[model samples]
Structures are given as C-alpha cells and as structure tokens.
Target: MSADGAGGVSRSPVERYTDRMVAALQRLEASDDPNLTFSRLIDVMGRSSHRLLILLFTLLNMLPGPPGFGGTIAWTTFGIALAMIFGWPIRLPALIGDRKLPLSLLIKLSERVAVAARYAARFSRPRLKWLTGAAATIPFGIFVMAISVVMTIPIPFINAIPNVGLCIMSFSMLNRDGVGLLAGLVVCLLGLTVAAAALFGAFELASTAIESIR
Candidate 1:
C-alpha cells in the first residue's frame, strides 16, 4: 500500500517507508491464518523483507527478556549481517522460521516501531545518499556483525546499547537517509567501545578475584 500525499503532493522517502511498515503490520493483523510464522511474516513484507527484518530483530533485541534471549537475537542478527555482506538470500532455518509468533505480541511490537518511525520521519530525509548506497553495505554489515557479537557477550545491562544503534541504522536504511546512517554509525562505534571496556573490566575483576583467592 502506497502512502499517496494529499492534494497530489509526493510523500518523502521516510514517510513512504513508514507507511509501508504500517501497511505490512495491518496486513498481518488482518490475516486469518492461525499459524503466523517468521517465513510468513517475511513473505508478507515482500520487497521490504531485508529492511523490515532488520528493524524487527533490532526492536526485538531492545525488549527485556529471559536469560540468553539476547544471545539468540545477536546470532540471528549476525546471520543477517552476513547476508547483507555476501548478497545471499535471507532465509531462516526451518527450525526457527517455522516457529509460530504470538500475533498479539507481534502487533504490539510493530505498533511501537511504527510510532517511532512516524515521529522520526518528521526529521529524516534522503540526504548523503552516498552513505546509503551500494558502496556502504560492506562496512555497515561489518559494523553490525561486530555489534551483534558484542551483544552476545554476557555483559549485564549492555544489550540495549548497540541495539539502539542498530534500530537507528535500520530506520536510516528504510528512509535512505545517509545523514541518519552516519549518526547510526557513530552510535554503533560508541556502543562497541563501551562494550569492549565493559568486557575488559570484567576480565580485570576476574583476575583480581583469582589473585585474592590464591
């Protein structure tokens, strides 16, 4: 579904992407199929698959969850990053893709993301087009892959940091906003630095504990 501008005005890229996401969510909500799997969700997203999946996974990573859930998301995102880098087809394994998602929870998450997208669309535009172009995919994929690895570390209270960057990156991609991509890159770097420091501190603490025990 296209978001046609009122009075024949053309919608911005940000607005268009946001509208696409909302429409996809609405379609999911309207579906009568009882078993809504990840594969089905991707099929519903059509050409928006890559961008929407990145957005979905990033948002899912931001949510609080039980032990090891962060690692799961991190690994999934790792695969996605590899796909982005290698130009491989994005597909989940049957084990994961076939798993059913709770429609209500999915809708709730999509609603939150949609609201954020709409708000961001006000300030986002397609500038610095070079950064969002084909040349940038390799670097972006590498950064995302690194961040995903950091997220998998059992660093308490740090899972959300990189994810915030990832969320921005996803939005920037959708909106084709290179300026936003630069901002997202900065955030990802900062998050990576913080995670590295935290990991270093953890090792230091462990070493101190071992010495004390000795």
Candidate 2:
C-alpha cells in the first residue's frame, strides 16, 4: 500500500506498481521533458538493480483473477516496465522507431541481449544455448503464463498474472541481451502453457459436473 499526495489508503503491491507506471506514462504524455529520453532511460535502467523489481512484477500481476480480466493488462505491463527503464514504453515491433519516441532503447536493449547470450554461450556451451536460456525462463514463465490463462477463466486464485507477465517480459526485452530476454521468454511461454492447460481442464470438469447434475 502507498499514500498518494491525498493520503488515501493505497492499493496492493500490484495496484501500486500499476498506478506508478501509469502515472509516469500520463506525465510523459503531458510533458516536453526531452530529458525523458529513451537512451537516457535505458542507460539509467541498466545502471540500476531492478532485477528484484522485475521478479516481483512478474509474481504479483501475472497470477490470476479480477485484475487479469483484461487482455491488455499483460501488454500494458510490458509497456510500463520498459518505459520505466527507458523513460518510455516500447516493444520489439516498434524497434524501427516511432516519430515521437527514440529507438535507441530498442537498439541498445537488443544489442545487450545478444552480447549476454554470447557470453553465456562460453559457459553453457553453444550446443545447449537455447536450452540453457529457455530452461531459466520455463519455471518462471510457466508460473506467470499459467496465471494469465487461468485469469481468463475468471478464477480468483491469482487474479493479476497478466500484468505480471507483461512487466517481466518488458524488462526481459528491454534488458539488451539475448540471454536474459530468452530466459524471460521461457518464463512467459511456460506460464502461458500452464494457463492454457488449466483452462481446458477446468472447462472439461465444469461440463462434466453440469452433465451429471442434469
């Protein structure tokens, strides 16, 4: 929970992250602060220890239920986490550059990821690169994506996994190197898979229960 200037009781961790990031975006929307540049943001983001934030963001929002009702939460979270690190939101599809925002963040992030992958290859072995990276992503990604899918079913267990996935994915992409990004992707894909399977099973069970009642 947080206290805004008005001093009202703040929302939960998930809500707080969303509020802060959304507010940042709204401010950017109204601003002429060129210092709010993407390059600077990327540099600044890299200079910080945001790995913890990334992990937490994944855990809180990508779980399941009420807040996860929207399809856009994941993508929205993706945007803000990237924006925070780079002073603006971004995606790989937008790597070509936007008229209003700098593409430097995109370029640098990709470069860094590639560099990290190459470095990792030295230890993990070229033959097992994808497996190594994907392995890291799978455990976390499964957890998140599972929540995302489950949320779509309107279950209240982990109601905000969609947002968490986006937040983590955003950081993974913005991280500037293949290793981290790939790991993040693993987390994403696995989570989605689990979510999908769970949804299917739940539907089947529900149908069976209904038939028996009839």
Candidate 3:
C-alpha cells in the first residue's frame, strides 16, 4: 500500500509486516537478480518518529510473556504497534486466539523493528536526544502508567513493572546524562520494588483487618 509523506497510513492490525517483508524478499529475487540489498530495504523504511518508534518498541516488549499469549492478540498487537510507530498499515488477516500461530514470524518481525530503529539511530540521534531530553514529561507519564500496572499484581506488584529499566533509561537518554540515566534506572528499579513491597504489605494489613472484624 502507498503511504503519504506525512507518514504512511496505518495498515490494518490484521496484517503482519514480517509476511509482507518476506513476500517482498521473494519478489526481489524472483528473477535471476541479486537478493534485495540492505541499503535498498533501508531506503524503503525511511526516517520515523521517535515517539511512535519508542511506543512500538514498548509494545513489542509486551510479547514473549503473559501479556501476549494468544494468537491474533499477539500478532495483531505486534502489527498494530509497528503500524502506529512506523505509521503504515500491515493488512494481515486476524488469526484470533489461534494457539498454533507462528511466533517465529513475530520474532523475526521484532528483529526487523530493531534493525529499522538502528537505522533511525544513524541520523536521528541528535533529534531523539533533543526530543526525549526536553520532554521529561514523556518519561514521567510512562513511569506513572507503569506504576499503575505494577500496583495491580497480587503482591509486590508495585515493583515488578515491566520496562521499569527501559523507562528509567529513557529519561537518562533524554537528558543526555549517561550517569544520571544509569542512576535513575537503579533508583527507579529499587524504588518500584520497594513501592511494590509496601503495597503488598498494605493489602495484607487490610485483608487481616477485615478478617479480624469478620
């Protein structure tokens, strides 16, 4: 599908980019022509937004775990995450709840996203640093949401928030303060864990109080 310059129009959550990329690969080598070159593929993806890119990466992180266990939900989440960040439609059919879905395909697609993100790194470093650094609010918001999720678990939920490391690292990366980021990560990690413990304790205390009253 053709994408506009403002950014590619999003593909349906149904489409898996890995399959599309694989097809494109086949067509490129259909003839006796050399396989699609690296530079060629890079040219096709182009520069993408740091915000969208980070969001995609975050969602992808949700995979390989409890968050993305089901079929259509997993791949669709993957496809839509990519589309949101890269700004293009994927168009893969939904395989809702299909347990036999090909995870290797999704893994492969995840790798591609990383590769594209790296390419973005070449020229987008300055921009990424500037945007993220100046936008502390971004990380703060992510931190808040992450905290909310962490608090939902049975015990110590406050501390085990996924991406706590990544989110903390983001602020460091944003501020262009390597040392600060590193420290922030450690602090947030511990702080979250401690917060989780506190929450669990509080819950236990409440449950105990109710039991005593009952």
lDDT of 1 by residue, 1-214 (tens): 1347687755666556556766776777776864577667667765235665777778878767678777877777777778878887677778666756566676787777667766787788778888877888888788778888888888787666678988898789877888898788788778878887888898999999999999
TM-scores of all candidate predictions against the true structure: 0.87, 0.36, 0.29
Local distance difference test, candidate 2: 0.41
Q: Write the per-residue lDDT of candidate 2 for residues 1-214, one digit (tens) a residue.
A: 2355476853333333333443444444456764434333323334232332343334334333244324333332344344444433333233311212333333343344345433443333223334324344434434444444444455543333344444445344333234545555565556567766777888899999999999
Q: What is the lDDT of residue 27 in candidate 3?
A: 49
Report every candidate's CA lDDT: 0.75, 0.41, 0.42
A best-first ranking of the candidates according to their lDDT comes to 1, 3, 2
Off by over 4 Å in 1: 1-6
Q: Write the per-residue lDDT of candidate 3 for residues 45-164, one digit (tens) a residue.
A: 232323222333343343554533422232433443344334454333423322332334444665565455444333332323443353554554455345435434443233334344
Cα lDDT of candidate 1 equals 0.75
Candidate 3 clashing pairs, residues 3+ apart or interchain: 10-89, 11-88, 11-89, 11-90, 14-92, 15-91, 15-92, 133-174, 150-157, 159-192
Each candidate structure's count of clashing pairs: 0, 33, 10
